[model samples]
Target: MTARWKDLCLDADDPAALGAFWAAVIGLEVDPDASPSTPGPVSLVGPTDGHRVWVNPTTTPRRVKHRLHLDVDAGSVAEVEALGARVVLPAEESGFGWTVMADPEGGEFCVFVRDEPPAYRLHGVVVDCRDPFAQAAWWGRVLGVEPVHHADEGYATLEGAGPDDRLTLDFVPVPEAKVTPNRVHWDLVGDRDELVLLGATHRWDTPGWTVLADPEGNEFCVFAA
Candidate 1:
C-alpha cells in the first residue's frame, strides 16, 4: 500500500468529551496522550492494525452539510445514540438498511445493522463528490487500492476486502459545492511529496501532520509517518 489509513480526525469544540464518546462507541479506550483539558488533540488508538481516532479541538461550528461521513454497523441504532449520537434520518429499511445520525457536535454519520461480528468496528468512510469514478481513482492511487468504478448507481467504491488492501473508501456523486471544513476527515499515512504529486493539494500543516485536500476539496491529513 502506498499509504495506510492512519486515523480519523474529528474536529470539535470539546476534544476530550467527543473523543470519549467515540471511544465508547468504537469499543476502545482513550489513549494516554489525551485528556479533557489537555488543550490539544486526543486520540483513541484502535486495537488491531494500529488504527487511530484523533479528536481535535476547533472553535468553528459546522455551517453546511458534510460531504463525507462515517458508516458503522452495530446491533442497534440506539446503542450508538446512547453514546452521544442522535438520529438525523430515521431508520430506513429498503435498499440500504441503515439510519442517518449525527454526533453531539452535529457531524453526520450512518449506522447499519451487522448480523455477524466485525473485526474492526469502523466500517467505511464515505465521500460525496461530483465525479465518483474520478475521485475514487485518485484516492485509490493515494491509498494504493484498486478502484472499482460503478456506473450504474453513479458511485465508485473500494472495499479493501481485496488481498492487497486494508481500508475501504467509497465515493458517491453530489451536485453541490463543499462550503466548510469537514468535521470528520481521514489521516492518510505515506510520503508527503508523493501524495502531493498524486493530485493532493497541501492545504496547511499541523504539528505532526500536513492537511491536504482531495480533488473535491475534501480535507484529509497526511501523517509524517
Candidate 2:
C-alpha cells in the first residue's frame, strides 16, 4: 500500500502574502475561491492538477534553515527578486547552476535560471537529511517509486509521481539533525495503518488527516484514499 503525492504545504505567518509571492514566482494562479481578506489557508494552482501549493497559517516564525524546500526554474534571478524574494546565495557561490533564494517569510528555495523557462516552473521538492540513501529508500518505499542515488553528488531522487514530469522528490545530504518541525511538507493519500507498519511514527491527528513523521522526523500528512 503506497501513498500517492497530493499537495505541497507551507507554513506561513501571512498566508495570503506568502501565497501571492509563490504564485508570482512559480507562475501559478491564486485559487479564485480563496478569500484575500481572510487569515486562512491560501492555495495556488497551476494550469493542471496535482501541483497545488497550499500556504497555511502559522504563528511560529522560522528560526533555522528549512529542512524541506523547493527548486524552481525561472527566466532570471532578477525577475524572482522583483517578486519580493531575497537572494541568499548567488549561482556563482553555489557551484551548482542554481541560485538560493528565500521567500518573504524567509523560507529557502532554489531557483535555476534558464534562457527559456520550462512550461512547468516547479522543478523538485528537496529534503535535507543526514543519510540521503536511507531517507530516499524509505520514502521510495512509501511512495512506491525507485530511488536514484547520486553518490558523487551526495543526493538521491525519486522521479515520476506527480502530474508534472519535471517534478521530483530529491533527498540531499546535510550535517545537522532536524530540530523542529519542517515549515514545508508534502501530503499524501494512502493507508495510515500501512504507513505506520512501514516505520512512520504517528505524530497526531486532525479532523481531516493524520500526521506522521518519517524516520528522520520530517512530518507529512496522510489522508484516506
Local accuracy by lDDT, each model: 0.77, 0.90
Which runs in model 1 stand beyond 4 Å of their true positions? 93-95, 116-119, 161-167
> For candidate 1, which ten residues in a row score worst on lDDT?
159-168
- Residue-by-residue lDDT tens digits, candidate 2, 1-225: 289888889999999999999888877889978636779999899866687888899988789999999999999999999999999999898788899999998899999999999766888999999998999999999888889989899999999866576899999999999998899999999999999999999999999999999999999999999
Clash count, predicted structure 2: 0
lDDT of candidate 2?
A: 0.90
Rate residue 26 of model 1 by lDDT: 62
* Runs off by more than 4 Å, candidate 2: none
Tell me, by lDDT, which candidate is best: 2
Judge candidate 2 at residue 130 and give its lDDT. 93
